[model samples]
Target: MSNTTGAERLRKRAQATALAVILSVAATSSLPSTNEGSKDMQNTGTTSPNASENLTDRQQAIVPIAAFAATGDIANLNTSLDHGLDAGITVTEAKEILVQVYAYAGFPRSLNALAELMKVLDMRKQRGIQDAAGRLPGSPIPTGDALLAAGTANQTRLSGGPVKGALLEFAPAIDVYLKTHLFGDIFERDNLDWQSRELATVSMLSALSGVDSQLQAHMRISMNVGLTANQLRQLGQVLADRVDGNVARRAQEALDRQLAIAPGP
Candidate 1:
């Protein structure tokens, strides 16, 4: 009888200890989970998806600057440059955009726009408006076969497929030049992102009269690289207000045609 009584007491004690351990574990587990949930909520509150979708202040300023640069409008370039600096765009970035303009608008316009920028900077300095000089390309450019390979990959991804057509076939050397120079050499610089480059390209094409096809194509590329249709519309408005009605009208027409062909997400 005594043995039976002692065994019953021992079992009761073990059961109580087991219950205590389970309760302790449940309590600790819930606290960390609650804390993690709170942390996630806090982090989510701090960011916005729309901010990434919309053009930044600097990008807004850049659109007009690019348009004016492509058109070789010295007076408008001066005004756009002032606005760009005020909007937090750096001197180096503005210069880079102008340099990239040569690939599309020809060297005459590019060099003239760059000279205009230098004058603007000099004038701004005389007035004591110090501007930030943005960072340059971070690494050395690739060469030879490596450059061609990288450019080919970049063109494939940006175009949503391998770039091939009759134009490239007719002049195979032009294809090599485009791949090795434009995509590989210019794009691989990495100082500017692809989206900005596309934006600048679109702006330049929009300013010119005979590049409707190129403008339409870049509108698609812009959308492919996360430029919303609405943002492109806003770009038209930028040209309208900052550039002129004629330039803005051409841009809008191009955008409308492109949208009709392939509506954006």
Candidate 2:
């Protein structure tokens, strides 16, 4: 009987030990996990308004390249060109961006920027970097009346309606040039899409002072081409990050003014 009683006591002790182990496991499970805390910290640390909507590496590289080219900062332009190529901007696209510089920054700056691109290419070639030559215009550009008609249509579509203003009325020749040459001849080239063209234009304008009116107009055109206001804000962020405070401030101000006049959906 004493042996049986001792056996029962041992069984009871085993049960009590098991219960204590189960309670310890329950208490441990009830406490917050370190991994969950780590996840929360990671999310909070990386979260930002523009984090998801930030510009791509190629687009970010274009910002400083265009800005420096517009402002005639050849040294910085050279560096940006190298960075742009490294970021996957093709040789043809780089040429196109610099070529379009003339429309806003003037012929001298455009020519200089193109020349700098040539130098950049030559150096890269020496270093055994065979940069991709992007595709040319897919279709033939029209001429004469056909060209004018196509350009006017492009301009109208880009402006979101008929672009009528005192400035165009005062200088009708400028209007023709804009429709035919700028929008028609250049824009007709399909190798570079309209979105990239507008991005280059806005970057150029943002780099220059006293062109807020044009800058603001392009900001609207930027939206008309399906670039979001958030993207433009991202552009400003790129400018601030890659270029300088003043250039970024100009872009942000122009964007703010444009959005104030027409809030994006």
Candidate 3:
């Protein structure tokens, strides 16, 4: 009896010790390690300082659409158009973006892109997808001298001041055309905002080679029109994800150059 009692006591003690060890292990596992705790603190504090400024779905849709249109990549443009429309870009807004492509990518590319848009719309309609037709220009475009004045004002505002240079001096007619037609005629259309226009311009410029200077200039103009550097960085990411890496690299480099010259406040 004494031996049996002793053995029973030993068994109970061993079971109790086992239970205690299991509880201790569970408690230790529940709490984070020291390194893990520090990492958690850093992540919670500074993982994304500007997360709110990231580009919207609609804005990101514009990057690939514009880049594909500029490079005459009709197949990718088709996909981007479908995505953009699905992302809440109205029919008129899409049209306006393609129309603006001519100013940078030339008439043929613009025309082809517009035709592709038409096809996309038709196909979507057949599939019972009713896309919204966005609004038109709310005001009339200026004419003659008024047009020139308006364009000049716009150029000054967009360029951040009166634009004077040897290029303008040597090509006086081009200057007049730029002020009168491109700025006045195209920019005066209030349906699309300047920020969107600059987004399209930057994307279009980024896709084309031998236009590094223009791309960099538009990067500055993009900032002047209220696009944040974080948003532009997001643009580059969109290009990389949806468009092409080379295109994104060009855009990022242009943005970097602009930021180096004029860091945002």
Candidate 4:
């Protein structure tokens, strides 16, 4: 065996300890109990009082689009976008999901998916299909400090509290961006409810590789926001049927991990 320095072993142990603490905090704090989330779920308008019922047509339409977009399957994304429009998913709602996609999938994929959407819409118009140009958020978006404050609040609620972890502490800017931009600006926008947004997020994360921790976190967030475990399982089936089996497997693994940690209703 090669000699390993005492300092190197200590450093490795410290890193492992930090990761465990972060994962513990994330799992415990990011998800509210079902009873705790009920009121918020009702207010969001994304689900019925019984969230376990089958997802609505619009919700189903969004699942594959989100998965394909996150995985950079442009051709499949294009087909799903057209199907989404045909299934009564308004342009505004679809646009909101794509914008949210950028937060997880990054700017390049998000931008490309959006561009694909525009092309889909233009082609549909040529084919004489009039996809609904959905309404924008009626309220004005907050600016400057107010925007930051609103985002912080939104982030707290979604995460079940103010998020704190080793990685966030290492790069506080990322936490700020998550709160101010991802949770605050994008989440504040109307048309899509928090539940649907979380659903899209969870679906996207499930398709992406090597982000099991984030995927697991989103699974909790999905539940906290209103999706039932049964609904998420159905989403896995949707991914298998509509997208890739591997993506579905990834989603199932994340969900399983979440369930093992926190058995929910």
lDDT of each: 0.67, 0.70, 0.72, 0.70
For 1-265, candidate 4 gives per-residue lDDT tens digits of 2346655754553444334323422121111112344334423423343434777777788899998888789999999999989887888878888877776678889899999999999999999998888766645667788878866676656555555666888877766676666655665665566666766877887787877777777776676666888888988998999998998999999889877766334
- Listed in order, each prediction's TM-score against the native is 0.78, 0.78, 0.80, 0.80
Relative to the unseen true structure, what is the Cα RMSD of model 4? 8.3
Off by over 4 Å in 1: 1-53, 263-265
Shift in Å, residue 241, candidate 1 = 1.0
Sort the candidates on lDDT, descending order. 3, 4, 2, 1
lDDT at position 97, candidate 1: 83
Q: After superposition, how far is residue 103 of candidate 2 from its true place, in Å?
A: 0.5
Root-mean-square deviation of every model: 21.8, 25.3, 24.9, 8.3
TM-score of 3: 0.80
Candidate 1 lowest-lDDT run of ten? 25-34
Sort by TM-score, best first. 4, 3, 2, 1
- Compared with the true structure, what per-residue lDDT tens digits does model 1 show for residues 109-162? 899999998998999999998898876665577899998987676655555556
Residues 1-265, candidate 3, lDDT per residue (tens digit)?
A: 9989877865653343323222211000000111223233221211122246877788788899999999999999999999999998889889988988887778999999999999999999999999989776665788999989877776666655666555557767767877777767776776666666767888888898877767777776676656788999999999899888999999999889867756235
Q: Which residue pairs clash in candidate 4?
A: none
- The clash count of every prediction, one per candidate, is 0, 0, 0, 0
